[model samples]
Target: MNRSSECITKDSSRLITTELKPPDISLVQEKSWNAAVQMFGSFLLAGFGMVAASLVLDVVQHWPVYEQVSEVYILVPALLGLKGNLEMTLASRLSTHAHLGHLENCLSTITLGNLCLVQCQAILVGFLAAMAAVAMGWIPSGEFDIHHAMLLCASSVLTASVASFVLGVIMIGVIVISKKLNINPDNIATPIAASLGDLTTLALLSWIATLLYRSIGTNILLPAIIIIIGAVLVPVCGYAAWKNKFTKQALDEGWVPVVSAMVISSAGGLILDFTVSNYKGIAVFQLVINGIGGNMAAVHASRLSTTLHTGQLEGPVISATTKLLLLMVVPGQLVFIYTIGYLKAGHTSLTPIFMLIYLSAALLQVFLLLIISHYMVVWMWKLGIDPDNSAIPYLTALGDLLGTALLGVAFHILYAIGDKDSDLGD
Candidate 1:
């Protein structure tokens, strides 16, 4: 009887184990599916926004301002990158704040303080990005015209200032609405900021440049006047940020990532400047690859930061979120590649070789970036730094570099293989 009872008990224990395993497996699968639904949806929206932005860039490339002001191409990535660093960081920070329950009142002092802080950073970075672009544009040719310099500077700073303010407001609204709707702002906020960041910044940049360029040497001093106004507001925004207890930590932190990101993006701009003229659809594809890669990394970074803040940084998050982001790259890139092929039909041929190279490059770029974002968030949290502010800037900047470099290499490979494609604007 004792032996029979022991066997029965063992059988029952085995049955229980078998019974529990399915639910555990199903639970994980369910979570992953839900995450896919959320993340992919938001990512797609952001992707389409970037597509629109890219089309705008394509059209803007033909504009008189773009043709006359050769420096505008150099300014494009720097300014857009500046936008990513500022607004996406703001989105990430706000998402973290919301997740931490600190943004229960969206208009709280913390929220407003962060807004002020971003505006301040925008003015400063915008001006600096302009300086960097102008230097990069002119230093190579050993020609520096003060008139062109003023046009570029004014256009950059004004675009930065204006775009940041507009996007800052949009980000706040997105976060607030997402919170009210029980959505993860981390999933959507950074991408939306990115989406609008590209379109808004580009539109403003083109318009502002055209306006400022026309004012050059006209006794307008409009560019100079605009610069002075931006300069004056820097200290004003700074004081507001410094005075706010909630945002003072911001002033002390985040500058390294922000400024470093600008420099890195400027390097990508140089790459674009060099390669954009050589390959057909390079400009269009550059934004798609860079924007998509950056958006994915930012999403991952924001999610990781939120997890760390919630004290849930564990093995599952590290593996699961990273996997989700990686899975997104292929499908997302397919959509973008197709759209670009359709739009640039005559100018860019959709050869199987080119498609393969493009997808392979994007996958590798996003994979490395996602991996970097994982370690970066964990490292920042371990070091007691807020990953939300620091990680996105670094990760996105790295994405820009990797995407630009990789895209350039892909084009070069095609060229090496005698795949003579049409040049840009053909």
Candidate 2:
């Protein structure tokens, strides 16, 4: 009887261990799988969105307004970068709030205040970008006409304001819905912000600039009037955002990143302005590549910000989430590259060498961006600065700069190789 009891006790202990182990492993695997799906879906959606936005940019570049106003080309990268900064930062902020349970109500003071803050910043940055573009354009060409200046300022301010309002609202809905559906907003919000940001801002800038351009000589007052309205709305939005507690800190300390990002992006704009004309399809591919890099970095930043907000200090340097994000880049970019080839097939061919170089450039851009996002978010948190407010702008701007510079190098290399090939053939 004693031997039988001993064997039964051992068997029970073994059963318990076996039962507990599988469930634990299953739970972990389930979580990792869900995260992968969330991130992959977001990236796929963002990739397609950028493909369409790049096409729009290519189309707009041929428009009379874009060609006539050289400053407009200089303004495009800056304005689009600023739009991404504002909306993605807004998304990151909201995602953090959602993860912390502060975003349970869509009409909450926190949500509304954050939205208002983006609007105010958009107004201020929009006008500043226009001024910077004008200066950049002037330094290179030594030509500054008041008519062109007014048109750029009006277009920038109006596009920024309208895009901010629309994108801000969309961000709120996205976050709220994600929360309701038991989805992680951090996984989806930033990419959507980037995806829609390029399309909406470029479309608005194109339409508004064309309309304003038409009225330049006949009614010079139109541009001036739009600028005045944008200026007036700044104070209104500021007042609204300031009355709430959740966003007051951001409003006080957020200008550095946003303004600095705009400057960095303007530098990229200058690069684009110089190199785009010489290259066959740089404009189309540049927007797509830049947006992809920024979107991936923003995803990493947004996820890290949420983790940091939840009080996890010593997290893994390269989490499964980061790996998933980095992995998505290759396939996502391959699709965009070939899509560009198909779209611009008449103008430019996607040779194997060019595609390989472009892919390498994109991979390098995203890999560096991921590393930066990881360190920047942690560093900002240690400094008592909110990563959600600070990291996305800088990361996205850096993405824009890296994407443009690397793309320029790739084209230059291709050109040299082509020249050599022609000589060899001769």
Candidate 3:
């Protein structure tokens, strides 16, 4: 009986040990880690590119056109945000095409159709964003002049037309390259496109704005002619796109998202309008923060949408892939915030309170983006809509709005904390 009891006790102990042992990592989890690592690495590389490109903003700040037309500052983020919106949509469409085996050739009908659609959207939205920027500038500054509006509109349209064509081609190339390498374009394309979009848009906007400012000096006819040409070109492109069935489908899938993004982007500009004075010389940092946040959210939205479409992810629960993505955000936000802060403001300006406020705002931005992407993708899927068609644009737009608002809040919080600290010291 004692021997029998010993055998049972030993068996029970063995069972306990087995139960306590960690399970081998599943294939799904392994894939999630691999995907996360690949995406995080790509984002880091793209981010460095954006940082280098953003130095152009310092040059822009020194430009006479920028200084003379402060409204251009407000227009900057809106224009870049719109560029990102269109390119992000293109990336999503390409990613979906890749997954569906339609990306076998760059010159495929679907690819051409989508390209035409994006270009048309770019022309229309660029013109409108510029006109809106003029109005936004007029609201507070009350410096509404037809020549100034025409110059701004002309600058926006010309820059956008060129940038969209170039960036769209680059994104298609990225999709092809990612496919050849067996990497997910969805993971890499949107962020890279966004970074490139910001850089190229800013550079082009500055060059075109300065050139227009000089060329049309007190000449209403030249500016008026340019604006008229821009206005006429929009409907012509739209009509052409509408006539093509495939392009029409692409436009149908893309326009609402674009309009929604514009609304959200305008809100971001409004936030900048209200809070930029508080930060004084550091207004350029807003572009960096918005670009980074928007890029991160775009990556997440693109990946999540792809996974959802592929049946690899379901519902709104955070997957291992998402957890790994979120883990990447923590260090990335810290590095960007600290590095840019030091470079722009100074190391001494990065006080603990400032760090805390910045980190909190950034982390909160990422967190909100993740949650928003998850739910938005799931809801679209349930509605029989393609999340790829809508998710990235919405996420990016929301990222801009949220990033701006959060930064404003962070600034206020830091000021209050500093005041409290000074009182204590006194």
Tell me each candidate's TM-score.
0.84, 0.84, 0.82
Tens digit per residue, CA lDDT, model 2, 195-274: 89888999999999999989977998999999999889899989888766667767876899988887787688789877
Task: Check candidate 2 and list the clashing pairs.
Answer: none
- In the range 1-426, model 1's lDDT, one tens digit per residue, is 333212111221111111111111221233767778878988888888888776788788998878987888878877787777788888887876676555553256766677778778888888887887788788789988888888888888888888888888888888889878767788888888888888899999998898877776675688889899989988888889887655666676779988888777768878888887777567678878988899999998887777666555335534777888888898988887887667653356778888888899998998899888888888877776778778888888899899999999998888888776565334
| Candidate 1 accuracy as lDDT | 0.77
lDDT of each: 0.77, 0.79, 0.70
Ranking under lDDT, best-scoring first? 2, 1, 3
- Candidate 3 lDDT by residue in tens digits, 60-86: 888988887777776886787777788
Cand. 3 TM to true fold: 0.82
In model 1, the number of clashes is: 0
By the lDDT metric, which is better: model 1 or model 3? 1
Q: What shift in Å separates residue 360 of candidate 3 from its native position after superposition?
A: 3.1
Clash pairs, candidate 1, are none
Query: Each model's RMSD to truth, in Å?
Result: 11.1, 10.8, 13.0
Worst 10 residues of 3 by lDDT: 9-18
How does residue 294 of candidate 2 score in lDDT? 89
